[model samples]
Target: MTKTLPLRSYQFFLSIIFLLFSAPLLAQDEGEEEKPKLTLGGALRFNYNLSSWKDGQKDRGGDFGYDMFRINAVGTYKNIFLNVEYRLYSEAFGGGFLKQGWMGYKFNEEDQIQVGLTQVPFGLQQYNSHNWFFNLTYYVGLEDDHDMGIKYIHDSERIQYQLAFFKNAEELQFGSTSEIDPSRYSYDIAGRNKEINQFNGKFIYKLGKDRNHQLGTSVQYGGIYNLDTKETGDHHGFAFHYEYLGEKWNVKAQGMIVDHNPITPDTISDNVLQFGAYGGTYGVAADFNLYSLAVSRSIPVEIGPISNLEFYNDFGFMDKAEDDFEDSFMNVTGVLITAGKVYTYIDYAAGYNHSWLGGNYVDDFSAGNPDAKWEARFNINIGYYF
Candidate 1:
């Protein structure tokens, strides 16, 4: 199915764009601040990968490539705010993708509303990872998840919550190619076509005297459609998260259960899971669980200009709904070095019963074959934020 922005999304974007450029002119009052507060920021990332398969397969072996580049702009006038982010280039999605651009107002400290393309507050905020690849949940549409919608957020000392409604979640604009499939990360569910409206809510609590510990819960509901059979389905999920950020060490974990039910039994594809939830496997109407855990700590040791050094380990697991599809998991041990606005990650990743990408089960990793059950990759990712 071709992805296109809905009328509402287009309006929201254009309206913000207009106001951002014309706000100064519209401020006719001489005493009032004629120029809005503007902030410009972005990041550039590059990645090099050396991957080795279990059977010594040479196809898609290794490469050094451009990860992505993004530019961010924020303009604020009193309680009104505008935020825009654009992906200038990427190898996977090709030329670019619109990450997010939203406008909002802060009625007060406790209440605010935003409309446009923004994150879907589900699961862990950005997945439990300090690496470039993040976790399997990201490939399955559970992390870095954004959509066009409106959200109401309430924040206080002890409680912070969000209520949101989104349409066309993770809409892809440039499309995909054979070598790089952008759809794998796209937020389109299987057997889902029309509308794909989603409603989500998240609540978090700060505990402990320092308020360094946070616990959160999330819920999501959406209507699905089958582009081929014209059938409808239902999607629902719930997640729980916990994190503790301390001076020396930080740890976070999140788990979620999702149920996908289709009205027509034969309306979905059994070969390709909808929205690339799983690689080459199918889960039309099923329930699955996703889990992620990460822990990291800073060391006093420094190297060259790198003043802050951290060692981390991240583990993620996915339990498919059907037993025929074996579960997949990944373990990544890495070091993160930070110097100013530049961060470098050197990581070694291992996958079991799955490819390094963690989309589908690997048949090569059969029950009896010891050598076939695992694959590994060594990667270096460097990014500079400005």
Candidate 2:
């Protein structure tokens, strides 16, 4: 089973070449060349781990693992585009097996009308679910894409909106009264793959004449009506990114505010268990023409004593605590403490992460408020785009 994202240097180079060559093809008759009708593309990705534990022990499978490979083909015709992806999950998914053949459809470039299973485009990093680079990766709060459903998108050149309605994507859509729907979902929730119909909306607004600054927000509302009970909730997220471009200097900052009713997704039934979390995510990047480095930080609100609901059970821990932060729980104060938790945890481990290369990180903390914590992640992807 492979679980890495492939690098596409050749395909990327070809894409550049094709973009330039397309000029002549487009000049022939506008639509006479048939736009090539088909495109060939694929990537080879690998990952090796060098961490003791982020969640737990990775040695459970092995110390180092390169377990993902993706091969895909994309086609476009007029305003319709089709993308099909093949995947090979590691032994973690199904004992070193092969699971590919996911298809998608996009209409008007903004709205995607897809079938089969695909990635759930919700957050900035979550879209990179297929891990080919195994290091410190980010996993957003969103469902996996391989479920079955038909989603509609509302996006254009700058502003974008995504509204999808679907059931589980892995299994067949169940009748409104199907008992298996809830039972299957109880274990992995994939059973309802798009089986649980939903409505999701995502929008982005770009500002500044040069289009260097933008604001985006994502909101979702829907209820899961399983065989036994009807569970429903709402999720809202607000994000903004601003950047100043200069010949030899570049400054930028971006952040998001996430608030979800009934914080946990599994059991939206606990009315008192309603949750609210907010954090500031920002970063900076500087360069001298050819060389550049950009670092950004994202700290989400995971403050809650109530561990999130996963599938049909509580399979996780809450990291926000005061006396014995060891046991994860909800932040009693329900306030934002971006760095306190990290600092305390670091102190507990007797380790420190210093600021280097113009990279300075500070956690939002309050004096003596031990439970005040934030999940701030600062990352720098210093690589050439081309």
Predicted structure with the largest TM-score when compared to the true one: 1
TM-score of each: 0.79, 0.45
Tell me the tens digit of each residue's lDDT in model 2 across 1-386. 11111246335434544443354445355545455377655443333333322335334432344444555667765544566655444544332211223334433345555544544444332321111111111112232333444445566667766555444434433466543321111112221111244345566676677654545554544333333334443334443433434333333333434333322345533221111011111111100001111222223445563222111000111122223222211111111123321111110110112111111222211011243333322211111110
Tens digit per residue, CA lDDT, model 1, 302-325:
677778888999898877676565
Model 2 off-target regions past 4 Å?
A: 1-36, 53-62, 95-121, 125-140, 143-147, 172-195, 225-386
Candidate 1 least-lDDT 10 residues? 174-183
lDDT of 2: 0.32
Clashes of each: 3, 37
List per-prediction Cα lDDT, in the order shown. 0.69, 0.32
The weakest ten consecutive residues by lDDT in model 2 span: 283-292
